[model samples]
Target: AAAVGATKQELTLSIAIVSLFSLLFLLAEPYAAMGLGLSDDVAGAWIGGTVDLTGGVVAGAAVVSARCEEVAAIIKMTQNSALGVYILLIAVLASRSGLGGKDAASPAPPAKGEGLVYGLWKKFPKFVLGYLFCSVVASSLADRERGIAVPLLGGVARWWFAIGFSGLGFSTSFRSLREQLDGPNVLVHY
Candidate 1:
């Protein structure tokens, strides 16, 4: 009934709000678990082991303390950050080209290939040098017990995760959403 009466714009806004809320809710548990340092299995165990309401709550908290053993999160975060940097650099180049539009026949592609190589080198060049920076350095200097790299990597990963999320949000707009809502006629499969 609400959808029937609402304007296209209003309906689109409603959908966006609902979708964002749903996504946040869905991610809450995993984010909490990641923050807590508990593996999913350990979190499950803690939750299942407890009986009282407080126990359940504490179990949830415990999950947050469990460190993630998965390397996928770190890799994904790095990939996302690299992608974001590439996009940002492209946007900057596009804007500069647009400003130069009056003087040029067509905008030339920025020397992004060189920039990308240089950027990658600047970002992680030490890895190729065999110098063993960061985690390796910490491990070598402080011993394995003191040099756990997860925390440091996790912090960097979270920062990139935020950048990726922010980039995604920036690309979303009400106009595109309205178009999608109005085009739902195509959604019918029958």
Candidate 2:
């Protein structure tokens, strides 16, 4: 949603974060399974929790096993289910701190002579309702079968994933990356 007008480099950096995490987790899965002797489910849960992003969690878990991928996807989706609550909390906090409802695009509802819900109505995003509704409907329709559920929701996920990477692939300039990586900031970060 926030990806409206960020520069190509900024977009690529966001993409790279997930990509790097996926690569790191994929490489570390071997050690986690062998050197650490963590089971597939446990490793999957760990990746799911740490990766945070849905695409990275799925991709990272795929290296371990199909079962791991399933577990990681479930955990990540579960985590995503709390997005509405997070948004609500953020809106309420922003409203309380007077950080929200100041923008002309989203006018603040009056507080005087109005209920608390009214005050927050201007701050809350309308799309969150759609998100929660879809989650609930999908949860109701969720099946264990790969042929059905995978194509149902997983295909949509993969499509969005592809679109994101495809944008990065097309927009990312090699020279830009080189400059970003060669700066004094790189040395400090490293």
Candidate 3:
């Protein structure tokens, strides 16, 4: 009975962790996509309709570009959901399998905090890869003629946003945030 209870608890925790991470991931995708899409649209409109207002057009373009960066940051943050899920899944599985179970008399938690650092480091590669991809896409789009790049970038951005927003719909909750802030550790921070 105890084992069954423990298993059920672990499974519930696992699902919660997965759902949260997935939600974060979903939010980020749309944020990035919308930024990209808006950038493309604004740039197109300014360039096409404001031939006489060169200064205004340039200013608008610059603003749009900054929006892209903001979106990219949001997207990167959302992507961090993957790491969150991985960590939680590992923890739950390890505990449930008796690898770190109290009954198994497992040794004390590591003193070095190596696991946390290593896990973060493992995620660095993906972050770096994402940055590289963004850089390549940005450069390619910038160098090409506006007509050639706008449609493609716009489409890609739309897809990213749609997927992210859909995921967010499934995962976000004001109640979860309220509960998190009620925790002892959060109180200590205040």
Candidate 4:
């Protein structure tokens, strides 16, 4: 939605809210898990599954145990697999709504026999395939010789995601971000 300029402020607010919630979850998960008498693995899975950020999930689980972090990362990857489907759904809806580049005044509902397959193909999150492939390979290797592959795969995945995030940070317009931060809307939203 933010990419297409649909409710940009709302998207920003959603991001902020999720970030805040993830931080809160990280802080609270351990005590809550202990109170509930949950095992470290279960607690980590719950944290990873619920939190919006993979880093937060990994960090949260790491605070519990290395074994927990491993479980958490895998759960996070599994959860992320659904993102492609979500994006596809969004693309279909957006195409029907004449979003992405079309004039809003004119509706561009798919023509008489136009199938959504093409639009979905165009909008699919292609990185998800790479993620899934890496996950499958990692899982296969992890089941072999003393499970040595888990840490190696996880360390690589962490750096890959970190680099991707760094790219995003580098690409972001600081001036635009400052303007957004300065607005009364930010206060009201908060």
Give the per-residue lDDT digits (tens) of candidate 4, residues 51-103: 78877888888877887788889999877877767766776777766565244
**What is the model-wide C-alpha lDDT for candidate 3?**
0.43
Q: Per-residue lDDT tens digits of candidate 1, residues 1-190?
A: 0102234344345545554544443346546556677666655443333222222333344434433223323333344336444544554544444321222222233345555344333333232233224436555665564546657765785687569557656756867775656565423311
Cα lDDT for residue 175, model 4?
Answer: 61
Pull out the clashing pairs in model 1: 36-64, 36-65, 36-66, 37-64, 37-65, 37-66, 37-67, 38-66
Candidate 3 wrong stretches, greater than 4 Å = 1-121, 125-128, 140-147, 183-190
User: Higher-TM-score candidate among 3 and 4?
Assistant: 4
Model 1 TM:
0.28
Clashes of each: 8, 0, 1, 0
Once superposed on the true structure, which residue ranges of model 4 sit more than 4 Å away at CA?
Answer: 1-17, 35-42, 65-74, 102-115, 135-156, 171-190
lDDT of each: 0.43, 0.65, 0.43, 0.67
TM-score of each: 0.28, 0.58, 0.31, 0.59
TM-score leader:
4
Better of 3 and 4 by lDDT: 4
Off by over 4 Å in 1: 1-147, 181-190
Best first by TM-score, ranked: 4, 2, 3, 1
lDDT of 4: 0.67
Summed over model 2, clashes come to: 0
Better of 1 and 3 by TM-score: 3
lDDT of each residue in 8-81, candidate 3, tens digit only? 23433344544454444343433443455655544434332322222233333344456533444344444443
Q: Pick the winner on lDDT between candidates 2 and 4.
A: 4
Indicate whether candidate 2 or candidate 3 has the larger TM-score.
Answer: 2
User: Quick one: best lDDT, which candidate?
Assistant: 4
